[model samples]
Target chain A: MKAIVHVQLKPGVLDPQGQAIAGALASLGYDEVTGARQGKVIELELSGTDHALARERVEAMCGQLLANMVIEQFSVEILD
Target chain B: MRVAVIVFPGSNCDRDVAEAIAQVTGKPPIMVWHRETTFFDVDLVILPGGFAYGDYLRPGAMAARSSVMRHVLDHAKAGGLVLGICNGFQVLTEIGLLPGALLPNAGMKFICKPVKLKVTRTSTPFTGSFTKGQYLDIPVAHHDGNYFAQKDELSRLEDNEQVVFRYENNPNGSINDIAGLSNVSGNVLGMMPHPERAMVHGKTRGDGYKLFNTLMETIR
Candidate 1:
């Protein structure tokens, strides 16, 4: 089984990299881009056939280490 | 003072902090590797600055889960003093020893310079030497030093006077200009400034020296 986690800064949190990227895009003549937010995507491979158990485990991983609950939130997707 | 400086793989400031502690305490600190499960007999445990684990996932994320942190957590639980500086501050936040998260600098820059800070409260274990509202000029070098906490938590920190230091110039856009924080019990401290880097008298303001000197006095 494969698990994918998407971690993103919570709403109202400032993302300087995303802001810089938006600025660079505007400088490159992309006027419609109002803003951008940056985040991380982590992929994991687990030796489990049960999707439910894999998701539960991956969410635990996100809570424990992958996503910082104070600043970021995460969503886990399981692929079999 | 019996001190232990935990050394993670990429920790570059462990020696500097150890040296500073030795100068103030009249004895060298024990350098504990990250893999050590026990902290042994020590009055203080220090997490110094550096890109621990190459900052692979997040700053301090990997190092916070290392073997030694369990012991550090236990030490803090038992009312032992723990000081986290720079990336060490990041580790404390990661391990939930302290509240809030240190976001990247608002300018998205790796800021390295001498900045001024104001002492918020002097009753904590870390800021006893400074007078109330005293200003300090210390060197802060880090990319992620902007502190963030939710509204209620921020108010809680303020109400309890858990905030020890606030930036004078708001260099990194930290909310409420918070530069250092103490836990509720005031036994643990996490700050972004490199107090160990400002120990010289003539060349630098040496305000950082006062922090160590005062800590020794308080512990004694």
Candidate 2:
């Protein structure tokens, strides 16, 4: 099984990379951009057979290493 | 004071921190690697500034999970004094040792310059050397040094007096202009400025000696 974790800074947290990207886009003549926030995505391959167990493990990984709970929120999805 | 400076794989400021500690405390600090399990006998643990793990994925994210950080977390939990400077500050936040995250600079450039920091609180060991509201010049060098936290968390930090230092000119667009903060117990301190770099009398543009001096006095 494969699990994908999407981690992002919580609301109100500054996203410098996203802001930079937004600026770059604006410079390229793409206006109407209200805001941008950057985040990370991690994909992990697991040997587990059960999908539920895989999800539990991925969530644990997020809490332990994948995401910083203080400022980041993560969601895990299982892929076959 | 016996100090332990944790050296990550990509850390560039370990020697600087050790030199500063030696200059202020008259004792060279133990240099511990990121993979080490034992922290040695030390009163203070410092996560020095640098591009740890080349700032891969996120600043200080990879280094935070290294073996040495487990010991750091344990030490901090046991009420040991831990100081994180610049990249070190990012690592602390990455490891959940401190609240908030350091994002990229608002201008999207790697900033390397000296800025004035106002000491908002003097109760912690980190800022015991400075008077409240006094400003000190410190150098900062990082691509990601803009600190961010939720509004409620910011309020809580203010209410608990955990907000230690504020940038006088708000260089990086950090929330509330916060430059440094202390943990609830006041044992863990994380700041974006490089106090270690400012420790020398001639090199530093400001009175950098006070940071180490005050911390040493408080710990002693």
Candidate 3:
């Protein structure tokens, strides 16, 4: 099974890269771009047949290595 | 003082920090790799400033998850002295060892220059050498040094007097001009300035050296 995790800064936490990207987009004539928040995407391949087990492993991974629970929030998805 | 400097793959300031500690404390610091699981009986552990893991994904974000950090966190929890500079500070915050995230400069520019910082509250393990309101000129080189925290958390920090240093000039738009902070226990210190780089006589007038000296005096 394959799993994907997207980690992002908590809503109130500042996102400098996202802000910089938003500014660059505006400068390049892309007005109407309201905001941008940068985040990380991780793809993992697991040797599990059960989706629940895969998700549990993914959650453990996030707690251990995949995401920093302090300032980041992560969501995982199982893929075929 | 027996010290250990944690060296991540992309850490560029480890040697400098080690040298500064050696110069002031008369003992060279051990260079520990990021993969190490133990600290090996050290009194002070420094997470020196640098582009750890090339500052990939986020500043100090990747490095915070390194294996060594687990040991570092454990050490801090056990009342060990931990000092995190610039990139080190980012890592500390990323790992939740310290409060506040270092946001980009309000101007969205990489700021590299000497800035004046005032010793706000020195009742901690890190700033006992300086008097309250004393100013030290230290060099800050970072794109993201602006510190942010929730309002209640900020109030809690203020109530506990965990704020150790504040910028004299407010160069980075940090809340309340905060430049450095300590953990609630005061054993963990995370600051954005490069005190090790400012240890030389001519480089920064040695104000930064006082910080190390102060720590040594307390620990010894």
Candidate 4:
């Protein structure tokens, strides 16, 4: 089984790299972009066969390690 | 003081910190690897700065879950002094040993320079030798040193006097200009500055010697 975890800074948190990207886009004449917030994606390949169990484990992993609960939020999706 | 400097997979400042401790306390600190679960006879524990675990999955996030951190958490709970510098501060926050989180600098730049830090409180083990509100010149180098906390938590930290150091000038957009903080018990401190690095040049009145000297006196 495989699971994909998307981790992102929560709303209202300042995204510095995102702001820098927005500025560079404006410099290149692509001024329509208002903002860009960066995050990360992690794909985990597991040996478990049970989808429900894998999802549960992945959610636990998000709280434990993948996402810093204080600053970032996470969403999980099971791969088909 | 018997100090122990914890070395993660990519910790580069462990030796510098050990040397600083040796210079001040006259005894070298024990360098404990990340795999070791036990630290022997350590009165103070330091998580030195570096790209621990190559800054994977965010700075300090991976190292917070490493094998030895379990022991570190226990040590902090036992009221042992724990100091986290730069990346170590990031790890302390990631592990929930300290409140708030460090993010990329607002300018999106990796800052490496000497900054002024005012000692907010002198009661803590790390700052007891320095006068309250006295400024210290310490070097800070990191990509993610901007500290953030919830509004209410900020007030709580203020009300409880947990803030140990505040930046003389806000360099990285840390909320409330917080440069360093102590836990409620005052045994653990997490800061963005590198006191060890600043120990070399002693011309500035704000140099980091008094901080280490104070800790040595208190522990001994």
List DockQ, one per candidate, in order: 0.90, 0.60, 0.37, 0.85
Estimate how well candidate 3 is docked, as a DockQ score: 0.37
lDDT of 2 by residue, B118-216 (tens): 999888888877799998888888888888887788788889989888999888888889999899989999999998778655754345677888888
Tell me which residue pairs clash in candidate 3: none
Error of 4 at A36 (Å): 1.4
Worst 10 residues of 3 chain A by lDDT: A63-72
Interface C-alpha RMSD after superposing true interface residues, each candidate, one decimal: 0.6, 1.9, 2.9, 0.7
Docking level of model 4: high
Descending-lDDT candidate ranking: 1, 4, 3, 2
Q: Estimate each model's TM-score.
A: 0.97, 0.91, 0.89, 0.96
Note the chain A TM-score of all models in turn.
Answer: 0.97, 0.94, 0.95, 0.92
**Candidate 2 — which pairs collide?**
none
- CAPRI level of candidate 3: acceptable
Error of 1 at B60 (Å): 0.8
How big an interface RMSD has model 3? 2.9
Clashes of 2: 0
Query: Can you give the lDDT of residue A10 in candidate 2?
Result: 84
State the lDDT of candidate 1 residue by residue for B1-220, as single tens digits. Answer: 8999999999999999988988778899999999997557888999999999998788999999999999999999999999999999999999999999999999888999999899988988778878988988888999999999988889988999999999999989999999999999888999999999888868754888899888888888
Using TM-score, rank the candidates from best to worst: 1, 4, 2, 3
lDDT for each candidate structure: 0.92, 0.86, 0.88, 0.89
